[model samples]
Target: MTYFVYILETMNNKTLKYNLLVKQFKNNIYTYSLYMLRNRMDADDATQEVLIRIWNNIDKFNYSAAKSYIMRITHNLCIDFLRKRNLLINRELEITEDIEESFGDESTESNPYLVMQMKIATQKIKEAIEKLPENLKSVFVLYEMQGMKYIEISKALEIPINNVKVNLFRARKKLQEELKIYESE
Candidate 1:
């Protein structure tokens, strides 16, 4: 009776901890999915699939490495979703911009001109990101948009840190070129 009670308590504790972990990263995972998949419905589906996999693999998980593991799973699933479609022609870009997330000097404010300009710029940026190659886009989204560190991205994407840096650099350069017309006078 005592042994069974201890086992039950341990199992409860593990489940509680896993639930907390899931809660902690849920938004990040969903946001990543949204950016990668570029559609709200697909992002929601991908997030659900990723979380289910996380729960199923919880027993084999180590807490410290859980984040990278989860992200890796997410990246793989997103790529798989893309591959199964056979081409990007079937993928639709979600036009709603999350411009409220300030990227350094860019501001989402109440001024009409500023707001209009920001919207235009945001649209251009979104187009630029969408046009990027998969390798560059994933690196850019993870490191720049998702706020993952280079090392974290490297681990999640299974690429070298230098490769992450190079890809990010290229992604930014391409965006600059693509959106050059939107630059302020």
Candidate 2:
């Protein structure tokens, strides 16, 4: 009963509905800001800004297009923040192939070596990801971590889909190179 009313309020743009909308989008807003800023304080600030904008503009929201609308807002805000910092933000990202290969369902109980190897590989991959250039890192996080399609990413970044593909390819190449060095060491 309460849940249904909340939804109605949200749809009808009541004061209660506005709060409900904020509750629903809060996690996504925080996560998006965190990914863009890579700092908790800045992410917090971004989240507040997004919430304020959403609250003030709730009347403009169309239920059918709400998801895409929110994402566009987040994407634009991130780009604006980056621009203000004079950063050449890239949206490409690479994941370590070796980590992907090792991700099969192997039981640690059956083979201790497999468990240890998985742990080490996971840590190494994380380290490698952190070391990647910002462009590759962003692309990797957006595609792999956030599970956004290349087309969606292209729209968000205002880049061509082909550029998204190329950036992903280059990011993968960088990851492969880093993995090779790790293996050789």
Candidate 3:
């Protein structure tokens, strides 16, 4: 009877920890997947698979490195998904509608011109990000958009720290050049 109670307690504690970890990283996983996969449906599927993998491997990984571990899984899953579907060519840019809707407030709604300009600017930036090469895009998304540190990006992408720095630098330079062209137009 005592052993049964101990088992129950252990299971409950593990479940609680798993829930917290999932909540903390779910959005990051989905966003990374979305940027990598370039499709909402595929991203959703990838996110679900990541969550399941996390739960399955909960006992195997250290909680201290959970972020990198989860992100590594997400990155690999997205890559596999892309490869399986042969989706490298003709990739369409998926500008998130959430960004546009988030700009809607009492003040912004009052100025239709401002709203339109904001959406256009947001669209252009998203398009620029989408146009980046895969290496640059992954580094950009993980480091800049996902707010991950250099070490974290290195771990997640399985790249050297120096490579992470170089890729991020190149991503920023390319984005700047792309956006500059848009500004000129």
Candidate 4:
């Protein structure tokens, strides 16, 4: 019947959209989760959950605002994961395990001394970021690392745009102070 054919076509279209959405945002979700949860396994679980939620609510969300919507889901899920594990406070991230992945591929330089220096600098920066307060860390990671805009972060974290700007500023200041201290040592 015509109705049956129409239903099948709609389902196919939805499936195609969902696939494209996943392809676009999966890395972002996983990266956010990795920073928030600070564990590979937990990040993986959170990414999977976010993807599942996106699929389930595919028809309900506006694709125009899809990035914020998807990131909000990811942020919430990461918070829940942290709370469930009682890591909301006194959280310590193992920076060594995925440091290369978190930052990027290892330097391809031929100079061993330069590569070593780069790795040390990267590790120090990562440690400083890990030491930031949760509020600042969230803002810093979302803006600097995830390439999210102020408005996008505000919507995703359910904070005002001004708050996003303030938090990002504070995060940067704190990171600078931390790096300064490291340099002195």
Q: Give per-residue lDDT, candidate 4, residue 159.
A: 99
Q: What is candidate 1's lDDT per residue for 1-185, written digit by digit as tens?
A: 35433443457466776677678789878877777777777789999999899888877775665667888999999888777756455365774545544432444336667776767767778867876778888898887877889898999999999999999999999878767745653
Backbone clash count for every predicted candidate, in the order shown:
0, 6, 0, 0
lDDT of 4 by residue, 1-185 (tens): 35433443356487887887888899999988887887778999999999999989987866666778889999999889988998777666675767566434445535657767777888898888877887898889989998989998999999999999999999999999999999999
lDDT of 3 at 117: 79
TM-score of 4: 0.84
Cα-based lDDT at residue 119, candidate 4: 74
| lDDT by residue (tens digit), candidate 3, 1-185 | 45433443356476876787788899999989888888888999999999999989877766656778889999999989989999888587665666666676744447888777777887888888888888899999998888999998899899999999999999999999999998998
Q: What are the runs in model 3 whose C-alpha is more than 4 Å off?
A: 1-12, 104-110
**What is the per-residue lDDT of model 2 for residues 1-185, given as tens digits with 9 covering 90 to 100?**
46544464456546776777777667766766655665556667778888888888877666444444665677678667767865445443233443455554565346868776776878677656655665666667668766778876776566788888888888889988998898899
Which number leads on TM-score?
3
Whole-model lDDT for model 2 versus the true structure?
Answer: 0.67
After the best TM-score superposition of candidate 4, give how far the Cα of residue 93 lies from its true spot, in angstroms. 2.2
> Every model's Cα RMSD, please?
6.8, 7.3, 5.6, 5.8
**Pairs in steric clash, model 3:** none
Error of 1 at 105 (Å): 22
